[model samples]
Target: MIAVGRIFRIQQELDCVALYFDRFESFSSTQVTSQVGLSYDSRISRLQWTDFAEAIPKLCCKTLADIPLIDDSAYVRELLQHAVMDDLLGPANGPNELIKDMSVRDRYLVGKLAPRETLDEGNDWGNSAVDEAEDVVPDDLEVKAKPAPPTAGKRTKGGEQPKDDEALGKGEPETSDEIDVSKNQSLVPSSFGITFCVDGEAERIEVEARWGRYERIHDHGITKTRKNKNKKTGKEEEIEVKVWQRIPCGGKMVLDLKQGPVSRRSPD
Candidate 1:
């Protein structure tokens, strides 16, 4: 009975310590304050660590946007540290909700907790799935972007010019440098225009090639890439999708298609 009682008391003490630390963190940092009288009346802001304990509760449920106007107080820093630890521990009062509710600036500090190696190529190291796809990145490096179709300014109305609005407005205005060029293109029939293997397994698909810059006016539109294979010879070929051809992140793309029969090679 005594041992159980002692354990309860220790737990209570620990809880109290945590609470005190949470509250103390808010006032621990240096703050900017308005300076008093000069020979000529002028307002100057001086930095000091002031009454943080009193000021902290005001930010109890506030976001990073709600940080005191003066900014970067020791108390706030400590509070943020405690909040991060709490988040990692999945604690109830370590400001996890408040941190989540914070503005972009505060969220940046949280994001910093992630290691540099994990964020090397905008890779999300925080997720376990990315860690598993270690081999995908290498294969991605081999693929290159497909060349854009002739631009609108370059298009002249003559011999083999496009006959329709849809044909005339093929590729969109997105920067080609920003786009991901695909490897393995296929050309096929109207019903099944192309054929290519994502993981080496054949996908009988269709491709759409476009001329100049085209843009999608709204969301939820479908853009198709076509490819085809000779059934008898099994010689596979794919025509490029001229409008917007981008190879997705190899790791993420492969993971997304893991349930499918073919697993895509890692991309650069």
Candidate 2:
């Protein structure tokens, strides 16, 4: 019961939608009842497992009217009237625009979806962990250090950005009662705590990924040809070279367009 591609979930923590999944032992909750006993699990829409990382970017730009999952067009229009501006999902999203015919108060969502620090605190990772990984991480796979968090609050959507440890200092209440013990059981390093089956083994690679940031991450490996001493001929022979695909916490793993059928397998 492994979970796979393009799955959408309303990140109850940040109140934004997110695309989430990877191969791992299937873990699910039975209609999770919240503190007041209302179940929020049904807010998720699980598409069947398959790979389509390449097509996801376009989705971010589309409005609910453009990509209606439910048949109720009128309802979508209603949500749009009071919802966040178009392009909710995106690396390609444009500046936040106000929904038409709505007041300033009704134009955006009520709460912030993700924490301010998570967005403002760019991952300042170092390359020291590359060689230590099972796969040689490519230089391009590196995510740059994020600039400092915004100092002033803007009146745009998703509430205001955090003002340095304010959420923690104030002991802000958890947005929802959604709780999972599985996070504590993750074997991988970060909160992106899942592993995959490649070449018949669980690749327990450590990654420094941010939760709730949905985007395409292209994985690469060191697949270069280098000269090596041929003990028999004592000559450098041009040999075919293959390398592992790096798993950066930064992106999703669709079957690499560079790879083919059976190029890898999901955990069984």
Candidate 3:
């Protein structure tokens, strides 16, 4: 059964890597023909295989003769070491960067392991990795699925439950269980509140608790907009977005739009 499990997992991993290679090939072809928005060079082939190299050892475990099936941490360290060696020989900076250039999973793992250093490093990542990293979406994109207008109201036995439409119109706070914290910055605010838009304009207001500081971040949401121009007509239009904010929140309050009209969208 254990052997069966290992084979199954290995098969799945290979299948995923094979699919990735196929996609990269397709993307490469599109680049050559200018059909795709982005272009990828032949070097992308190397980055794609790097992920498979890390997985193979783990999947084979004791079956492989060269390396033992140590803990995941040990395996990851070994993989990083080998990757670094390969990059150094090829005139690249290090293996860690190349590993991150491989796939999202590898990138995230590398991100976690690498020390918090200067993000704006002046190095030639050969355009391919730079484009790859830029194209990669952060894990937090999943958090955007949260409902907008982060209203955090508690339920009561005797009182009426608020309706969703009413909440949307009222610009209520979103309820969330995840606490928002930055690995590099301090998010501790003196006050808390919800943010939204009006007449295609965005605004944020403080929700001063009548009681005290609500340190608990229940949930949050956000709305975004983008501008696009017509290729043929050269006309521009604003596209509005209502995304669920993944940030941490503790309380809710009724928005006092009478405070002022939103002149423009404010960054949080």
For residue 129, what is the lDDT in candidate 2?
25
Report the Cα lDDT for residue 241, model 2: 37
Model 2 lDDT-worst window of ten: 111-120
Question: C-alpha displacement of 2 in model 2, angstroms?
Answer: 54
In candidate 1, what are the lDDT values of residues 1-268, reduced to their tens digit? 0000001111122124322222111432232222221122354333232443243333343333344343347955775665565444322232212222122222232211212323444744332212322211233334354444544544446756665544555444434232111111221111123455665564342333321111212233434433466677677644322222112121122234334575434333
Q: Give per-residue lDDT, candidate 1, residue 31.
A: 28
| Model 2 stretches with alpha carbons more than 4 Å out | 1-188, 192-224, 244-268
Better of 1 and 2 by lDDT: 2
TM-scores for every predicted model: 0.19, 0.14, 0.18
Structural RMSD, model 1: 25.0
Worst 10 residues of 3 by lDDT: 19-28
Count backbone clashes in candidate 1: 35
Candidate 1 lDDT = 0.31
Q: State, as a TM-score between 0 and 1, how close model 2 is to the true structure.
A: 0.14
Candidate 3 lDDT by residue in tens digits, 73-151: 6645755654564333221222112222133332233211111222344422111222222233343432333445634
Question: lDDT of model 1 at residue 245?
Answer: 19
Off by over 4 Å in 1: 1-17, 21-73, 84-150, 153-160, 163-169, 172-268
Candidate 3 residues lying further than 4 Å off, grouped into runs, are: 1-108, 111-127, 130-135, 141-159, 165-268
lDDT score, residue 9, model 1? 11
The stretch of ten residues in a row with the least summed lDDT in candidate 1 is 1-10
